[model samples]
Target chain A: MKTKSTIAIIGSTGNMGSAIAKSLAKGSNRLLLFGREDTKLQTLKNDIHTLNSGADVEAIGCPKDASWEADIVILAVPYAAEAAVAEEIRPYVTQKIVISIANPMNETFDGMVTPADSSAAQELQKLLPDAQVVKAFNTTYAANFAEPVIAGVPADAYVAGDDEKAVQTVTELVQSMGLNPVVAGGLAVSHTLEHMQLLLIQLTVKNNYNWHAGWKILHN
Target chain B: MFSELEKNLRQHITLTTDEFDRVKRYFVPKKLRRKQFMLEASDVCTRMAFVSKGALFSYSTSEKGSINVVQFAFESWWMADLYSFFTEEPSKLYIEALEDSELLLLKADRLQPLLADVPAMETYLRILYQNAYVALQRRLEETIGLTAEQRYLRFMERDGRLLLRVPQHMIASYLGVTPETLSRIRKQVS
Candidate 1:
């Protein structure tokens, strides 16, 4: 029943970030878009407004400023850059939802970069004890974000977070993007979720699945 | 769009051009895509919006998620859940755009400052509220007293222009009748 949450998407000019922004525009939430280039973010903002003119969106150049004003913060940077961005906005994100959407793939894209025991999301959670770090969108490719339906079923957006309310908030958010949200249990489940992405990426690259593959759970 | 607002303003109170110039800053401009929700039942109505373009409708829902259509607003009309706005409670109604809409939004917190800054705005708001009250009473009377056929006839007479903009299903909801019943009534009238 929640409506109109303020969400900040850092690195919003990236593939995952822009795709999420465009689809999320259809919802009533307010979006604070931040990226390396202000002009690019503004262009992305305009595109979203084109899709839904009633969307409340602003392009912010400062990451800290955008994160400071938002209720939920989605870190869409690569795994390599996540630590720096997390620390930069650490102080401002206390009690706020910080979603990690990076799949820590190795340079060759054949394997993951994170330790076997941890994930990008878990590392983010460790960095910001005050913020609710949830892992989502890591399991799906950027292409699937625009059109969530693949194989005639809505792709499952697997979300993992320790905070139930934050998890629920993200579930609502994923639903807003016209996807199905599967609560994949506590943040520890993020390691598996990240691995799932790694496997999918490898499969797509190796077998030429065209990067349109995503997860879906079917039940009677 | 500003002309619609200006014409609406010119009817009630006199405002110097400079005064009207200052009035525009208090309101933020927003656009809603067709079928976009302006306010959902779970949201405490934080903004009262004036429709500058397009059309919108508001409705309340039962626990089972069936809607009871309440009102529709077109260009130059204002829409808000007054009870939610005043009491700061979660709204019981959902306000949605029937078409791509441009709205000038007045935030709840800005109301006092706006009235204080522009004394003429108070006169305009008073007239707006009075007319809104009169309209509400008339709507209630029609809802309770009129037969379904009479209501359909009255709607065709008064809001026939909306037929092109609003869907027949929503219009049926607004008339407090089933879609089949409305379809039968439409056939009877034709």
Candidate 2:
């Protein structure tokens, strides 16, 4: 069964967040959008309404408020911006699914900012000890979210989390967005997911993929 | 995305936009890449998918490593392991996308409410099942009682549209013949 739930996009105005909001707006889920810029949030809400008029999208002022109200919370901000956001929403996100889509790429884009022992999702989970942290959507560029299928394949969205129920929920959400959801492993697997995106960014920067390339595993 | 489904239903029964709108809400949209298995062996089918775009096929594998193609579903056609969906049992069949496909899925739980709320939908379903029953009865009769050439002719008569879309070996499997036998029969028929 398709379970409809309220999802809060904490950084709804950013590229990945807005893309996810627009994509999920097409479905039956209710969205509580929070962001740093009010004007951009309003514009995103309007665009979503244009895309799906019957969509339930609301722009909220407070991150904690949005987190408390939503069943699933997606932190779609950059790795540099997640700490402040996480601290603010920590209390509200207890026992909730908190998705971390941050890639801790260093300035040169060749390495990671996160320490060798921990990934961004792991750090976020450590910060909010009660929340279920899931790492996903960091593998592909935001453009893929608009049209997930490339050639004949849906972009693979690898999801890793400690909570089985939360992972399943995110898997269903990914499937609803028309992408293939592969369960990578537990929350510790976030390290590999982060590194995978780092390599993707490196490949795109070195090659002529034009930031449109994504991961797709071919199997017979 | 529901346009194809609406069109298929309209062919059987007439409904206003309002009624159609109500019926559409009961479905969830799902897209699958080519060769993706929507329903696999030992998995319980929770929902029935109605294809809106692309093609799919249902098949079962034997212990001898041969596949028996049972059905091919194109636009507006529905694919599900009915035994699994109805009885909540594990299925032995495999339903794979023949190409990248867009589908509208109706979960088993919603089926009853949808049918109850929309009587026209019930009528549409009944008509479809009736037609399907007749086609299956004919297929079984030909498969058991008729010769291979007769079966091929009957299959050609009914699924001529699929000839261009489906591969030859799958068609041979559906007709219960080997690839070489099917090739010889095709040459003879021509």
Candidate 3:
């Protein structure tokens, strides 16, 4: 039998990272939580241990010297920190699927603050060309990540990358999180998905709607 | 013309020549006169067009009938009202050729068959949609969060090629600013 995929969450102390760790814990996969803050990382480790007794959970403070040899690595840090983090983690990641959830939204609430040609994911991909960079998990809120369904709204997640095998790998991970995975096209198509998230965020703020609303591709 | 199409396809779709032929069979080659509408408001966008040559713009009319340009597709670009194309609902936008154009048009009906016949094309299309979606998200974020000057700088830095290909007015429309305002902003930045 194939060994269950090993998964690591970088910036695991954050809400989104912790939530992803929790979601992956159900699949009998080994989970590694890496973060800059030792106290927060330890709390998350304890929390995951409490909830998922069978899942292997380990937490470590940064300057990640050891190699991260996982089937998948979820970069859950803020957009501002992504470039540096990608640089630091590049040497450690080889032949693994690197998933970037960072959205480069400017702090002033101006939508995305990144260069038009260079998305946070694209930049991360450039930083680690050896790893199959798949952009996923940026659209949905952290709260939605942990919930089976948000207010009965089925959140559809999009997976996009140049690699077919990497996209398939991510599709499975999305399914494991109890969300529908829509193959939204290739790596460049990630621009549209990121824009869709911005539209959703705008609608949420403008209409006083909950961040729980997520998109699904409906086929007749 | 075919080379332009090939280049665009290279960016979006990754398939073997045989696989591309399988998917290409589904598309119908067509020509559009300047200012002709490929798709119009209230029409269901059943097709996506690849610009083999010339240019096209996908836009919407505001309630007052003012045009809001959403996307501009130059040679080798892909143009479609994705929301309308997928949902089969009346499109709120219009897709029209800005210049006399040659195109390879693919309809929704052809998608599944192509996917079935050329499995690699599915990967191509999946990647295409993913890239488009990612761009849309970034644009939306820019519209909401960034200042006008910042947005202009970001747009220029990101799509310098587009700045050269597209007209100033259209760029202003996409940026949600007035053409004169865009000019002034450009002057200030320069």
Candidate 4:
């Protein structure tokens, strides 16, 4: 972009978060990895540096450190922990483009646990009113994030956010990972993205398909 | 019947008159009076209903006889015990008309051929489910996460038309609140 964007990832120790971190490391961007576990964060940072030696990645122990100056922040925490995490990151959230990849799937994975009338991103946006919350990457599996390509075809990233600039920022980030970005519409559509993830999970379980299968929007 | 469905389909995908005519025959039109049950528990839900006019809803009752409204389908919306329709199992949900409603019914037997003959309809159906899946999940999350007051306010903000049409008790059930609680919330909001 205009300059090497500083990308802060909350919950970077998780599989989804780490996968996103690994994929985005290819570009000339600095990564601030936020996590509760110090050793896990250190391990992830080392792994990223090993994959791309020139990658500037640092492990941040505190959530507030992420707010210092990140151009965009990705929330990769569990759906249940979203409010707590949002509160922790609140002070630094002003004007920052926040990307949510959390799906409010129930513990049984049979269905979702969120209120049927709202979505995870909507809840997060309400909690962090100052931040621009965009929903992306929740529909695509973490396995696909490693390369964003399967069978020589690039995976698609459906992004939804109220702010056009924020959506554009995340679209570029999705592009950097070698994925195609489709602006799915305003932030309210995040509900659709989250539910789409649940449907994918159900389909995979029913068909005995592995987590690697991804969806592509085919148009004429 | 085809005109309303065509209008809804056009919002997602444009279909030529020839393709539309080919696929339209698969749907059978049906009507239900207000409070009539279209689908009952313990019966196989062999068909999915698309609301052409008026409203209907599906609900499941707890062992204690308390009901939780799972879905409400208005004009241009689809309703069925999807699991039962797909798997041919007995449905645990009850779908009843809330108003004198007309629906375009598509049986499971006809769905495959309809898709096979007009393959583009598959894409349209996918887009339809994409939107429905999202709406259902959002409603589920809101039902779980928000308070009765918050949920009622959100419903009022998003789908206030339902408030004018649906019975107060049914709306309360949908919000997972008791009728009295809904009344209190309404009073508080006003």
Task: State which candidate has the highest TM-score.
Answer: 1
| Consecutive 10-residue window with the lowest summed lDDT within model 3 chain B | B20-29
Off by over 4 Å in 2: A1-3, B1-190
Question: Which scores greater on TM-score, model 2 or model 4?
Answer: 2
Which lDDT tens digits does candidate 4 get at residues A56-155?
A: 7888767666744465789988988889888977756655678989899998887778788889999999998867899999878888888577678886
| Candidate 3 local lDDT, residue B109 | 62
Distance from true location, Cα of B11 in model 1, Å? 53
User: What range of 10 consecutive residues in model 2 chain B has the weakest lDDT sum?
Assistant: B24-33
RMSD of each: 13.1, 16.6, 25.1, 23.6
Q: Which stretches of candidate 3 lie over 4 Å from their true place?
A: A63-67, B1-190
lDDT of 4 by residue, B2-28 (tens): 678999888878788998877666665
DockQ of each: 0.07, 0.01, 0.01, 0.01
lDDT tens readout by residue for model 2, B1-190: 6789988999989999999988876765555557766777887787788999999999999999899998888888888877788799888898888888877777676789899878889898788667767767887898899999889998888778867888899999989999999999999999
Best model number under DockQ: 1
lDDT (Cα atoms) of all candidates against the true structure: 0.85, 0.85, 0.77, 0.83
lDDT of 3 at A117: 69
**TM-score of candidate 3 on Cα atoms, chains taken together:** 0.52
Docking class for model 3 is incorrect
Question: Could you give candidate 3's per-residue lDDT for residues B1-190 as a string of tens digits?
Answer: 2566666667765767876555555655555657767787887887888888888998988888778998888777789989988988888888887888777777676678768887767777877799789989998999999999899999889877756867788889889999999999999999
